[model samples]
Target: MTALGPAASLRDAYGAALVELGERDPGLVVLDADLSGSTRTQLFGQRFPDRFFNVGVMEPTMMSIAAGLSLGGRTVFASTFAVFAAGQAYNFVRQSVCYNRANVKIVATHGGLLVGGDGGTHQMVEDIGLMRGLPGMTVVVPSDAATTRAATFALAERNGPAYVRLTRESLPTVTDGSFRIGRAAELRSGNDLTVVAVGALVARGLELADDLARLGISVRVLDAASVKPFDEAAILKAARETGAILVLEEHSVLTGVGALVAAVTAEGHPVPVRRIGVPDLFGESGDPWALLDRFGMSMQRIRDEAWDLLRLRGRVE
Candidate 1:
């Protein structure tokens, strides 16, 4: 069986795709807010110097500039850290991108507290919640590098404002390139319980799938990457098939992806769903893996939760 975590990280794939996309579309322009190197847009900027713009430390202005470029018939991808992309540029995105419904894409890096040593200040746990709340905005969190690359290309074809979040560290790519936005991708099939996750947590679900499969417990895993315009059909179907659901995420449980998934599931399926994510509190300075383990966001925790949920449903040993 193939193991998780040995694959290339999504950050590298995202960076390489930024360059490839720039080469493919002459109208493809990249804007970085003084974080070209850290956000990894520098790789693209180096190749397409004329097409890439460094707008200094101003993230809000960067968003506006991107919107303006889009209005002028250019496809603009504004890159920045998640905190500034969502927090600092919130108004620019809401007014210029969403209000105008511009076809600009905002690519956020270092999303979630997994940003590690950089600590709480740089981490953006609320980015998904922030973008998901915007009107005319499509929020996506790719499970890995391969999927993130596909998402970047897919954004060129999508209309309206799009927000795609990426991580700073490398994550295993569990999805094998057949990702459709707003449609949940099932990695495992089970009749006992369903584990719905997005972004980095998808790896956790995959790991849990291996464990549960070994114990003769049927476990289903779904990668619900698109947050806004979510796949309600896939979610409800999973609930009906498994009889219960578990939402796993790297963001806060309050106002995070898990909450939105629960709300939608409750409305459509009304099935019992447990949420696994960061608690309603700020993160501390620590190793990313250690912090996730403590907050019940690790693969081990996901596996444990799946087992517990199946037992609660009386479907496991």
Candidate 2:
């Protein structure tokens, strides 16, 4: 855990990290589907012009080219909006990347409802579920700019197909720049309950834990950055120690990290679990924070859910 800092953009951090990784590894290549500016892959293109490719607006073609590059022993990273990467280029990713287990990193930005005014057409709320279902695909959703920076480097070293989810909005820095795939970081420790959160919701989870602390409710907050190959050991430990769990995410409740957490607990140690996320519906155009609140992912909603879980567990009178 690290001290909270001012808000920073994960996309910017990701772009800078790609430049750093390119400088370190000559085999690393980048591809963008006409969204380099918005997805921040332009930074890497500027630094490594020869190693970067702009594949026009064809996301599926970009994915296929990345897969071919990976098969040629080059570490390929492709960037696009989540909607385009996961929705438009899904078949290419499945047949070329995941099926072949190519070393391609699909770093999609503007995930979830945080695309702000992009409306339902551009916002990708189902990306996590889509990517996680792919076999041999590593799913990572870093909580902040620092963690995103670390995850960018980690994915470069990892030899497999991976999907790194990033947000369009700025988020508070939470982790201390150390991130590993398939590992969860415990931001705060307590015994009453455990709140598992990811991406932008991590900062909100920390706020809820702090607020609950004043009311004598101790909450252990776990940042579940890696959605697939989830940290089951940490989750089971929390279940045994706290006996209650609440999962928070900026994506849909169905097939999100919350559902994975529930599956983990059910197999090992059954406990009361409450999940707070967007219900089964599309997101509309609005302020990013307003959209989050409207979708019931606000800090206030998380706090209320915490209280409800506590009551159900007989921890609150």
Candidate 3:
């Protein structure tokens, strides 16, 4: 609803939200694979030590335990890096949690190139695709701290398997606290082209819209927070109204929200779509912002792609 004032860490908001949830719901329990400090689950662990389980570095074991706890009538929140939670423990999550439709919330932190100095090994850009592929799993990537807090609470209340991808770097608050899973928020409206963004790229999408506006290009921006069970209505509306779309994300362009948006539009509207994100390659150690720029996730790349797509559609010269 309003422009972002200052950057706030999503992981910080996640920890606070977990503490609040612990206070409100005694049925809630948390498990971490020794990454509670980085993943921000330590706040919950400190406040509700009895309800928290530090399962060492065994991510799969933690996932299995979470599934068991869920079966025992407790809403479980498991924390770990995106790579471990969605990549390493994927099989366990698929069979143990998703198969039984366990009420488990896998809140993964340090997703994408935002891990910065941690390099490619720790920075997970494919977790969204992995989690989204699982049957009966709800995937969410909140853009900022406020939305992260909202998503955390929403996942805690909802039943079944869910993955909330979070970033390590701080992000400006772009949401107004009105967050609903499976629904996208339209930040800017225009008719020339639609820019659909997820996670950390939403703020860049908004800035892209502003810059394009100054250049006489009317671009609409849609925050695709809910990767799984995506906002089909909003996407289709943008395709129909704008006639062209560009999908932006911090993950790989191959299997992230861009791929999903393209598939959805191809089936329903058949509009010209372009995807901007990390390439199908591993990232190296560097400043987070530099990595984003190098991987073509920056506003410049988005602007270039928008212009290219518009030209292809004969909307620009």
| Per-candidate alpha-carbon RMSD to the true structure | 1.4, 1.2, 1.2
What is the C-alpha RMSD, rounded to one decimal, of candidate 3? 1.2
> Please, what are the lDDT tens digits per residue for candidate 2 over residues 1-317?
34578899999999999999999999899999999998899999999999999999999988888999999788999999999999999999899899988999999999999998979998898899999999999999999999999999888988999999999999999888778788899999999999999999999888988888888888999999988778999999999999999999999899899888999999999999998998999999999999999999977888788998899879898
Taking all chains together, each candidate's TM-score versus the true structure is: 0.96, 0.98, 0.97
* lDDT by residue for model 3 (148-220), tens: 9999988888889999999999998888867899899988889999999988889988888888788788888
lDDT of 2 at 243: 94
lDDT of 1 by residue, 266-287 (tens): 8888878888998877777788
Clashes of each: 1, 0, 0
lDDT of each: 0.84, 0.92, 0.91
Candidate 3, after superposition: displacement of residue 98 in Å? 0.6
Largest lDDT belongs to which candidate? 2
Clashing pairs in 2: none
RMSD score of candidate 2 (Å): 1.2
Candidate 2 worst ten-residue window by lDDT: 1-10
Clashing residue pairs, candidate 1? 10-145
Off by over 4 Å in 3: none
Candidate 2 at 192: error in angstroms? Answer: 0.5
